[model samples]
Target: MNKTKNYDLTIIIPMYNEYENMERLEKKLTGYINKARMKTCVLLVNDGSTDGSLGRIKDICERNTDFFYISYDSNRGLSTALNAGIDNTESRYLGYMDADMQTDAEDFDLLLQHIGSNQIVTGIRARRKDTGFKRMQSKIANSFRRRMTGDTATDTGCPLKVMWTEYARRIQFFDGMHRFLPALFSLEGANFKEVPVRHYPRTAGKSKYHLWNRLRKPFADCIAFRWMKNRYIRYEINEKEL
Candidate 1:
């Protein structure tokens, strides 16, 4: 699995106005990079952060040899940032996490242990540390999306995940496709694994999602996913000539 990669893994961290969490990101990520089971580097994708996050990202990347970055002129939202990160990834396996630090960085090792066989291995926030209201909203959204797309996912919203570069690139790009990472990979008969991991409360920065996007937007995205699922192409070649 690691044979063809420049590094064994490339962890993609997408930031949007996360100036407050920059130092935390550096500290947490550096610790993981040093102790990770596989050779790992980080790609910090800047989504046009207005709170001086891009500058901090630059400094972090400059000081750390394992860190690199790609920047956009302005904010283009999470899905776009995720796609760009995947597109730029040069490793055989790609990992993803949020800048908010709600998810533990060390738990990525747990997800990585399952990626050798599965095309996608994602974390499940077994014990989420959010308010009851926030948890309820996520629960409702997850249920609705699962019913609509027929996806057997427990917590696709968990930012910590590891996927083969091929599978990551194969995912069809859409505005809210990040919410359906499991379904997108499974759509092509790709194997997937779900592992329970630690979750934490947001200590700094603001949550990008809210009542509308958290609940309503996913409903619309599920409909979009359903439409695209029906139309998405699939194929297998017993023999081929190039």
Candidate 2:
């Protein structure tokens, strides 16, 4: 078992080749966590970045009281990074965001305020800031995903999300699982809600995902998601004695 934590929220940031943005990312994230109404801390998962990102991440974690970090050997996809963060964290509530400051960390407070009675609270990317091609790909992918999975998530790929630690740990992840969080959580029979959040364009580094990797790969993974959905198990013990 991992050590338990008393913090109200833990923010998990999965970073890959984001050295240029680490300085601003850490400063903004730390500020938000520190000033948030609830006590919060940041956990950065460095996904084997070849750039100087790892060193920068280490420096931030060491110098900042509210920041911690972990690193993997080779580059893993976003889903894997998120899973690693969830597995390592000890907080009661876990929130996820990308290393890019596209989504403001301050918006976390809005979601956190209404987390009551819901196991998962996610953000809807309001006025999404993305390239034209990226926006087109997202629209196509999201349409197919909603029709196939019936997840009803307007923006499943939104970077800002919060969930109960227990429910988050129970999720099954795949390569494209990052885009299907709402569906997966629903499969676990947990309640969820979404609120609009601000979005901004990348200020540093480049996006790791492209059209094929973002759209085509996810289309294939949707089949895997479907299989998991059909076979998912849930139960309630009316009476238990241990």
Candidate 3:
């Protein structure tokens, strides 16, 4: 676990089968890294994309010194990829965005501004470009999630988020952990802020989520989160010496 403290931020992009979006993603990310307020790098997590995504990822990493990647043999879903990135990142700050490129990489600057005082800074997609049905689904899901988790996050599903690496590594990873980040961070006594960010339509890769996984599964996962919250352990020591 060598902590490479040289970089101030590491952005984690989780890719499943987004081969089509790789070229544009690399260009946009490279532009961000070049102009970021702090030293920044990218960590591409390839969640076993059967499409030729791994090859593209390797090529991208080879071309950019600030880019890196990790891949597994089988698809493990977004939460697993996120946890892997958190476990491996050594930067002071960590960020997450989808490979589909619906959110702008430059919005990370907006989130980074709040990272000094908050454990997590997440984005709320203002004037979302998603279809009406997708927005409706998100509305219902967010409403239910707020009621169930009491996280009060208007848009937990928004992939653009930045958090202190210490707090991010403390998050408990589960099948649907991505949807409960704010709640899980809260369990660790972490505070977060939300900023409005720009959103774009998906021009390249198809979205991986659908009605069942986006809505029904999240409802079930919320129940699971509540159960874990009830039994979650927390303690503190008055004094300690190493």
Per-candidate TM vs. native? Answer: 0.96, 0.96, 0.97
Evaluated with TM-score, which candidate comes out highest? 3
CA error at residue 240 for candidate 3, angstroms: 3.5
* Clash pairs detected, candidate 1: none
Candidate topping lDDT: 3
Q: After superposing candidate 3, which stretches have Cα over 4 Å from the reference?
A: 1-4
Cα lDDT for residue 139, model 1? Answer: 93
Candidate number with the higher lDDT (1 or 3): 3
Pairs that collide in candidate 2 are none
Off by over 4 Å in 1: 1-5
Q: Indicate whether candidate 2 or candidate 3 has the larger lDDT.
A: 3
Q: How accurate locally, in lDDT, is each candidate?
A: 0.90, 0.88, 0.93
Give the alpha carbon lDDT tens digit for every residue of 112-148 in model 3: 8899999999999999999999999999999999999
Candidate 1 global lDDT: 0.90
